[model samples]
Target: MNYFTRVLKYGIDYSYFGLLNILFNILYAIFSALAFVSFIPMLDVLFKQTEIVYTKPEYTGIGNIREYLESYFNYYLSNQLETDVSSTLIIVVGIVVFFFLMKNIFNYLALYNITFVKNGLLKNLRENLYSKVLNMPISYFLNKKKGDLMSRITADILEIQTSYLSILELMVREPLTILFTLIVMFTISPRLTLFVTLFIPISGFIISIIGKKLRKDSKEVQQQQSNFLSIIDETISGQKVIKSFLSESFFLDKFKSINSLLFKFSNKVINRKNLAGPFSEFMGILVIGVLLWFGGKMVLISETISGTTFIVFMGLAYNILTPAKNLSKSFYSIKKGNAAAERVFEIIEYNNDRVDQKRDVELIKFENKITFENIEFNYGDSKILDKISFTINKGESVALVGSSGSGKTTIANILNGFFNPKSGNLLIDNNNISQITKESLYKNISIVTQESILFNDSILNNIKIGNLDTKKEDVINAAKEANAHEFIEQQLDGYNTMIGDYGNKLSGGQKQRLTIARAMLKSPSILILDEATSSLDSKSEKKIQDAINKLMQGKTSLIIAHKFSTIKKCDKIILIDKGKIIAQGTHEELINSNSSYKNMNELQI
Candidate 1:
């Protein structure tokens, strides 16, 4: 489907609003033509061209209705003129004013109804983008920039909203205005109306050529916008790195380059889009000039069209220009918005192949064990985990310790279903992990990662995120067990105190402890700790390690830690090197038997 058509589908749910909008627009179109047509009688009166009808006209069929109405109106004018010409002129002007007022009222009503459809589409589109982002697997975002994704969700969607108004109006309002006006023009003089209608396709074809170029340029503008936004994101996130290396000039130059591209392409799109309005108006005026010459000859020489009627025909022709210019504007707008629409719909329609295809099996508990059998995974051509296998029985705490880039975190991620192994099976109590329903599997599992992840929300809310039904006392108890209760209570708002972005308001240890408390509150039967204390100092590490141990009690735990001290008490420790497990044993047994494990332990100690 065309990208614009796909976006229009989102408004289907607001059909009633669209129906009302179309109805009111029909009324507006009728009145819009009537508003200008009403002045024809006044013009006739001014020109002393009003025929005095002594007898009222009889009712006629639809074909002669225009002639009948004209005669009746002449009869009324003649009677009124006999009394007073000034009063009759005032009455004619009054009728014209009434038609103009009705035209605007119906136009306002049409816009009021379309507002519901417009705002509703925006709301629903934002929600769909957000929900898609949330459900999308971690691997899906590996090749995408966070800042680019942010731009698609925010700026590009806004572009779609602005263009959507033009689309809706183009559908019913503008065309109807032109249609009704043309019908009246045809009635006054078919030759002039045909002449005007012939000019339309030529004007449209010219505007279309410009629009085609604008589409390509508009895409470049949107892409450049994404590039600058990505640079901004990187600059903000790596500010410390840039400042530490004294490389502000390098980043500034980098941003300026992308920003310059954005500025150039944006101006191109804007300049081309602006051409549409003026060109359309100029074409309308050109056609109007031809009408004046052609119709003036008919009125004066041929005497086929009357002088007063020709003047009224000119008024109707001018009325057609406003809708003509707006329709052209809509054409250019859709061309530009097509780029943004494609960007946004790409995310919404992303094929996340990592989502488990077989989700019928429920994993309500970790009753027996988790077994990784012949697991193989890769990032493109580079292997991250190869033919790997390990197991952790229920209620047993197992640790994976390895050097950096040795696949410890990768293994933990695979176990957590964040990434599917290229070839292998992960089993929970003999049930294929990939087949387990995500909701049920997640319900039984909790993870505390190396970096403390907390929202900018109250302390109590952060802990209660995944476990919203947990009572306050249970939260406090969980906090106490994780060694976070003292610092949390020390804050002015206690549990209600707000944590800043990524919990930056708290110390490294406080952040880590709060994460532990959040995990403990869930009370999951299976827990995974991926270097929960790697960045903390020894003092903080000891406090967090104590919390981890307590959170692991009676729970089947998988720990990926670099600091061997944190996992020494695990039931089994697996040492991995270069995507392969070199040894697996209890810490004491590994220290006694494996020289690699012994050296790593000695080095850390």
Candidate 2:
């Protein structure tokens, strides 16, 4: 019930449709009761069992409603029966048919209007989850599974919609159907209605017991589904590795093992869920038998309610059974939906420790230099960087030469405001970078990392990602500067060619150059190249080197490189090892003085 209430919070925008549904449900409930009640008059007039009244009934107040209705129905029937009994019977049957028709029409209208509410909730909930995922920090997903998140957004949300849809009708239509029917039953015979009300609560209690464990059982199923989904996602992403390793049997066994568990879990949940309908029906039939035994004594022995009126009372009593059965079914559905709703809301409500710090002061421009003073950083208990400090002057191209895991990339991330140091400060142009807004900070910064990141779209669209406002001619110019223009023009559709997923259709060199083209198009004031050309062959590296030199002509640049040859021409080189700067000087100065830098340089040759 708690989960059910939380899911409804997103439905506030569709309250107008909810109101229409309620209004139509009220009409539906009224007609549903009247449709059954119509039999009372029809049976009397058709069978000629009821005595006729010579005079019309007088007006009465609400307290005597039952007596007044009976008097009025008999008065009208007597008048009509004075003519042909066949014609009167036909007229009575037509009235009953009309009542049933109106009952169906209003029921449909109630469901139709609520469709907007349910569908709107579905749209809003999915959108909210997607928006939350997009806004989450990169660190938040480090321990999370991509496929599990996908399942929460896709399959889990769908489950919430399917199971909880009955809740809308349960809230208004089902309860009111039962309420209006009970009123009709009481009017026909209060004693029989009294017995029904007592038995109803007992059945409802038993039904509640059956659904108690449903939520816990359903949560287990949902969790296992997310696990299998993660495995599938990981398998697809690592398909090349599996094939190259010839480990097909290993992955197959793993998938099959998880699938086997899922089959068991699904069967358990399905069997439990399936029991609700049959159990509820069985209980309803049992109650109907008890009601018949009790009511039959009142009609046959006591002779209080007329035979025709008792029959109508039984019809009204039976009407309660359908809604009561539906009510139990809806109860079980809500239980199932609770599990899915909890999973989806877990992501939506998750706390992101790395969310951008909101500050009133937004940095508007970059000037002078960037400085890191007494900076310290840690990844868990391990020290990633200790007392690190560096400075990059405006328009001065500096290079960081370090082995893998030497914290050079971490330094670049701090400089670009992707991370904050645990101690000390990072400043830009004498102002604290912490005080700077991330959006404004990123506006002046650009990165060309080792791996090329591209979307599944036209090459034109992918290139425009850096600056959407950049014109076609300027894009071509940028591509040419990055040495990507020649190959792009060779494609079937040139710039308009679809790159396929992650730009897989392009070669490694072409993809990397396209990233460089994107960074060039942005024309940011600061550029960080993290091992950008290290992964390419010598021929490709030379072309990219010329492009990088051109791209860094006047920008304040920081280059992290494993290849010593690439940083030889930089104005200054900082050599890092074990998360600390071991030496700093021009390339020639380092070769002449520092044996550590000299030995590392000679080994690369």
Candidate 3:
């Protein structure tokens, strides 16, 4: 379906609230017209045009209800004029004030009800976007910018709220107000009303032509904004690298370039949007001028309409312009809103190729082994892993040794179900890994990466993230096992110490130890260490290595290490070169047999 249809579908899902707004708006429109129409009688009283009646007027059937009400009102006013002309004018003024008050009251109620639906839709849209982002596979984010996704969720959604969602008011109140005003105008003078109708289509056609470029311009503005936001995110995230390289001016130039494009697109969009209001207003006044010339001739020459009635018709005609202008603006806003909704729905409706299938069997524990049978994976068109086959038996620690681009980390990613091979069957205990749910598979495995990923939270909460229900004693014990307890205890608040963003307040060693502590708390059946200690100093490496040894005991482990010394004691080592496994043996066996393995080991030593 089209974007507009999709947006309307979302609004219709909350039709209960929308219906309430519509009902109140209908009342508001009716009362608003009556409030202006009440001016007709007051004008008569002021101009001394009251028709005096000697007796009460007879009630007529509903078919002639309009005439009957007019007669009844005249009879009451005539009697009041005879008694006290000043008092009769006072009563007419009171009735006019009452109608206006009721009109405003209904208008307020309409807006109040619409607010609930508008805000509620925005809340649901954001929530759904977040949930989809969380569930998307890792590969989905590989090509996406953090800032672009962030813009979709924040600024783009807000644009939809203000531009599109606010159109809810125009949809109900403005159209109904114009519709009711037309009915009153037609009753006063059909000839002038028909003349007004002819110009409406012409004005609408002109306004639509002006707005033809709005959606395209709005899309450009939103895209430029996303680009600007992406640059900001990249700049902040890589501030350290930029500062270390003394490339501040380089990034500043990049930001200014994108910002300039954003400013240009914004100007174009606003120029088009602002044009709608004035153009519609001018067209409306032109219509009014024509109506005055024609309707005045009918009143003064043809004598078809009275002076007071013609004045009321003019008021109704002017009132129609307000809603008409609002309707035109709403159309422009819908175009912008449609553009934003397209961006939002792109993320929400993205097809996740790596979605897990429903699994009836739960992988509660790893018993036998994890095997990769003839695995072949590709990154775009280039092969990353080719016919790679290996197995790590239960409680065995196997290290994958390879060059930087030799797909060692890809194996770890596949093992954790973050990705699936293009052609392979990964099995645990002879059961296909794809048949196992990711949640249950991840529950039995834990990973520690080269970079420590920590939040800006208390150390206690950070450690507890591995297992929320973990006890305080268990957290301390895990920290102790990772050789982190001593440093943690030295802090002012110990476990309760608030770690600044990404644990920036802590040293590299301390941060790595905290991550190890988190993994240790999970205590999974299988563990994958992807150069977890590669970034630490020798002293910190030794401490973390000791923790790794403690955590790896009696657990099936896969190690991807840059330093051969870290994995020298593994049960076996698989040496890969350019997406193919060249050899597999213990370190001593590889050193004696394989030249590639011997050379790598020599360089590290």
TM-score of each: 0.98, 0.94, 0.96
**Poorest stretch of ten by lDDT in candidate 1:** 162-171
* Top candidate, metric TM-score: 1
lDDT of 2 by residue, 1-605 (tens): 89888888788899999999999999999999999888877887766776688787777789887778778877777887887778888888998999999999999999999999988988888899999998776556766888788889888998898899657777789899989889878767777888778867897788778787888888887888888899888888899999999999998898898888878877877787788778767876777887788878877998877788877877887788888878888888898889999999999998754335543356676779888898888877988888888888898889998788999999998887767788988889887877777778888999999999999999888888999998999999999999999999999999999999999999889999999999999999999999999889988999898899899988999999989888898888998888898888899999999998999999999
Judge candidate 2 against the unseen true structure and give its global Cα lDDT, from 0 to 1.
0.86
Question: Which regions of candidate 1 fall more than 4 Å away from where they truly are?
Answer: 353-355
- lDDT-better candidate, 1 vs 2: 1
For model 3, give the RMSD to the true fold. 1.9
Deviation of model 3 at 245, angstroms = 3.0
What are the RMSDs of all candidates, in order? 1.3, 2.2, 1.9
Clashing residue pairs, backbone N/CA/C < 3 A, model 2 = none
